[model samples]
Target: MAMNDGMSGPGSNSLKGITFLLVDRNEALLRSFQETLASYGAAVYSVCDISKVKDVFKEVKVDVFLADMEATGQETSALIRSFRDSNPGGSFFLLIDRVTYKDALSLIGPEADDYFFKPLDPDRFAQTIETALGQSRPKSNSLAVIEPYVEQLKPYLIFRSPEMKQVLMNLPRIAASNQTVLISGETGTGKEIVARAIHVLSRRAEGNFVAVNCGAIPDSLMEGELFGHEKGAFTGAHKTHRGKFELADNGTLLLDEIGDMPLSLQVKLLRVLEEGVIYRLGGERPTAVNVRILAATRIDLIK
Candidate 1:
């Protein structure tokens, strides 16, 4: 049976375990929202201080961020833009009064996945978050893409090989601690599967997981794909966006084919790991994230 850790608050249904960050300038509304979220089993962090909002996010694992669009339209947009730039892969919900819905959408644009009108519909709001979470859920089981017997070294993988066994034994120990694990193995040897296994057994098992192929993206766009780009950062960058690092902030990020990563990009990636933060492709502010990294490569990293 699944053990209940009672993170839910009043009025929270079975979906209370998901974490949501509520950012509003109004203290009263923030508390009310927190209470509602807690009742349903959610881990809530209410932030009324605009100055500390980003700081709070750096430390907490927020599944969905709900921001008030009325707090200084220009500053709010900039804040939202910064949030998107830093967390390229995370999801967000916007809260706007009925009068400002159109303007908010026009200003925030595509970066806003869903919006909530004032005099909110609790049932519908809950449903929307649930659906968004469901749609973005990564395929956890090994058989998601590969057949049960493929023996493929991918998402869900199995191996009885001696080298593989050594990796498996060390996985739990590695996953339980915070360490940078470099998975070096031959192709088709299930390197990615080893990464997935580590994530599954780790403390962040319930959070989202994202996988990116360092070798697949072009050298020019690799940073944007991994860290994200701000609107007008480049000619085609029409709007603010989040990248994989931000998306997988509280979860795991599987870096496949790390050996093929360009030298320049390697420097950037190393900095992110070392600095424990990231800046958007065109932006200068760094965003902190909590992500378990699992990298797979078919070549010798040191060579």
Candidate 2:
């Protein structure tokens, strides 16, 4: 389905430039799946070779990763964790046989956002993918027409709050620039929704808009989570993982709850902000990221 013009605040379809990495050892299934998503205007890359998953990620800029759990199984869990650790910004899903739907849920648990059962229902799959994409899309500035409730949409977002409308009016103008934006608001104020509107209105709307919740991350691994780490960088590091900066190389990075970030990691984060480069935990090279940083905080950063 085509997204309404300017519904996402004046950009093209939210899916237009976003990429999907569809991995399955099964050629027929992978093709069928890709075709289904493609019909909905998705930019899907289907990969059949399991061994080359890393190669694809390294070369391609993908916004989401969808894998066949039935085909990948436990053998891929380590890979999944590794992927999650490195590319914390991308959304992940699993495709499983109907009989193993429960098994799929149990296997991936919180690791995966959702999964598709075998004999895939095209419409349902489309809806699920859209919802997941909405969740993944970075919040931009847009008019918030607070109705009794807000539903995800393409162009204009409906909300009932007049304050939100004022914010939306400014979005179009604000989106024209490429300066770093830091949104401050209370919980449930829809900081992300606003951020996404800005993304849709901005020049980089065609590129990926990745969100990373700084507060949701555990303090223990915050370093490895944002900057990634080389395999054997630490005790549990079995493989090289991609960090949020790497995943959002040319996209927008929403640093949610920046205030909650531990003081220790703040030093490293400041360097990234200033230098536009990240150092993997165990790796020596400082990789550069050309990303638009949009941060949200519930507290008064000025204070």
The TM-score measured for candidate 1 stands at: 0.49
Tens digits of per-residue lDDT, candidate 2, 140-258, equal 45433222113322344554577876775566545544457899999988899889877765546667778888889999888888889999999989999998888887577889999
Candidate 1 on 226-277: residue-level lDDT in tens? 9998999999899989999999986889999987788998898877765557
Q: In model 2, where do residues sit more than 4 Å from their true spots? A: 1-156
Clashes of each: 19, 24
**Best TM-score goes to which candidate?**
2
Q: Which is the leading candidate under lDDT?
A: 2
**Lowest lDDT 10-mer window, candidate 2?**
144-153
109: Cα error in model 1, Å: 45
What clash count does candidate 1 reach?
19
If scored against the real structure, what TM-score would every candidate get? 0.49, 0.50
lDDT accuracy of residue 57 in candidate 2? 71
All-Cα superposition RMSD per candidate: 14.1, 16.2
